[model samples]
Target: MITIKVPCSSANIGPGFDVVGLSLSIWLTLQVNIVTTTTTTDTTPPPHTLNCNITYEGEGASHVPLAADANLITRTALYVLKCHGQRTFPRTTHVHIVNPIPLGRGLGSSGAAVVAGVLLANSVSKLGLSKDRMMDYCLMIERHPDNVMAAMMGGFVGSYLRELDPADMERKEIPLAEVLPEPAGGINTGLRPPEPPLGIGHYIKFGWAKEVKAVAIIPDFEVSTATAREVLPEVYSKKDMACLSPITGTSGIFNLQRLAVLTTALTRSPPDAELIFQAMQDKVHQPYRKHLIPGLPEILASVTPQSHPGLLGICLSGAGPTILALATHNFEHIAEMIMARFKQEGITCRYELLEPAYEGAQVIES
Candidate 1:
């Protein structure tokens, strides 16, 4: 028997779309116990005749459909078992899940499952696979690296996949030099992503900060991840992508500035709410996702220093509905203001005050 506790995650932190995330305090606990049993009196249970019993607790457990196709946990578990070269399923296997995070509310419900499934499989099989290997498989399964990192490694995280020189792997600070590798065949192949014969494939970087905390305003209604994704435009101008300087000047949400502010905000013990508020101001996905959340515009407008002094910054957690407020103080006040805004528009909502979970995902026993 093995028990795995994986923290839920919040991703796309404002400006850093698909690149930033944080693990919340809430967790989805999975308990898997493998036992021996046979249905037939002759003791002839077929291959994969595992008595699989799955149970769920907490938010969305009642109504949410648990289709075998959509259950990342079960899928990844089967994959992990396959990876371990385990051909036969346990005769009697009981799997239990307890979730506090809301599904389809942009609170990283799937991310938790991904982490949980991989961890559960690895533990049950006694694979002793490295964390990196687990992460690679998880990314392939979930398609969300930022959320994966937060759930796997915990705390506030900024993650991205990029090609780089092996020599630059240990770069501690800024002033990076890009040195193109010379081809072994002598012919120049021009600049390209590092993969295959060219070099090692793209590697994902996970930067973690354990100090930052957040307040999530989770609404009663849900937003489908696919629906929210479909509404976003397929492309954007480079200037719009980077938020070009000069014209917008100081007020503009420059990528470099946003990145710097976010990293600093997370690293600092007592996060600067005003700085983070400005830092998290994004021109990315939120504008397009507002309509999905009722009274979103009003909620955004409701947070002010005078009204919600504890609120550091607020943005859509991932794709929709649930809004996260990053802060170091006055969590209740910030949550109150957000709930008030939601109530003003007759929207029912609840809020949770959460600190960053630095441990990520771990097994309770060996």
Candidate 2:
């Protein structure tokens, strides 16, 4: 049996939006066991039998569509199997998914499933696909490369788009280069790069694993991506742009200044209440997306005032009703305090203290 354990991920840590993501240890584990086909002169069940059973558990099992052809993860695996030239399903394969990740709340639950699908296919087929290639396939399926990278590579990753160079592919002979192809042809053709392309992509590492513990507070309601995108204005006046200069200036958020801001904020306060609260400031996305998140003001005000000294930063997790607060170390007391603060607001929320997962997604034999 091939068991694929994929980490859950949270993207857009405040200002990063689509460009930044972090993975948590909590995972959705998928176990697939291939059933034996016919034996020599003996009657054995045939592989790919229509009677093969697929089961899902944990987070969204009931809601996840049951038909193998309709299931997202199953479909993804099938795609890979087809790519590997496997026309038939393995006989009586039993598939199980244990999910801890929440869906559509900006915690990357979907990305985990996509990753799970690709990894499961690779393992079952024994197709020795390279990690980079597998990552590319997963990312293409996910469409959010940064989050996919975090789900695949683990830990904290910062992504920025760059033109794909054709020379990079002369060695691999990848038929499609727009994703990682010759820069000139792909760029000229206006063909967008595929989601979740190969390599770790253009990314950088920040902070240590033990040094970070993230607190994710998810509100009850869901927000549509379209609505959140609409909240972003298409244009801003030069004066409004000028007003943003300081935040966008040499020490702007787009740079390491954002992290510096958090570090500085935490350093100044008593390390209990003041420092951590001050560190949550954002000049970029939060201020804009707040409109979409109900009770955000109350949630923010509550968490900020009761901040723990160990806290590094706090910001929206994607287009969120989910908020992520990061810390320099384990802060159980602080976490309880924060959770209490939110609970008092009567918001339906759950919190988990998680470290940066650096291993990404992988298969475990069961």
On residues 1-366, what C-alpha lDDT tens digit does candidate 1 reach at each position?
A: 778898888888888888878888898998777765555553764333233556777887877434322355765565556545553335566678888888888989888888888887787667886676777657555655788888988777777654546654543121211112222221121122121112211333344344456889888888988899888889966655665456645444465578677776666656666777778877667888888888887777678555676667788889868888876678887887788888877888899888778778989863
Deviation of model 1 at 344, angstroms? 2.6
- lDDT (C-alpha) at residue 281 in model 1: 72
Against the unseen true structure, what C-alpha lDDT does each candidate score?
0.69, 0.64
What is the Cα-based TM-score of model 2? 0.75
TM-score list, all predictions: 0.80, 0.75
Candidate 2 lDDT over residue span 175-291, tens digit each? 333332322321122133333334635666554434456787666667765577788767754432323454546422332344444433333433443444454455555667777
Off by over 4 Å in 1: 36-43, 46-49, 64-70, 162-212, 242-253
Predicted structure with the largest TM-score when compared to the true one: 1
Worst 10 residues of 2 by lDDT: 181-190
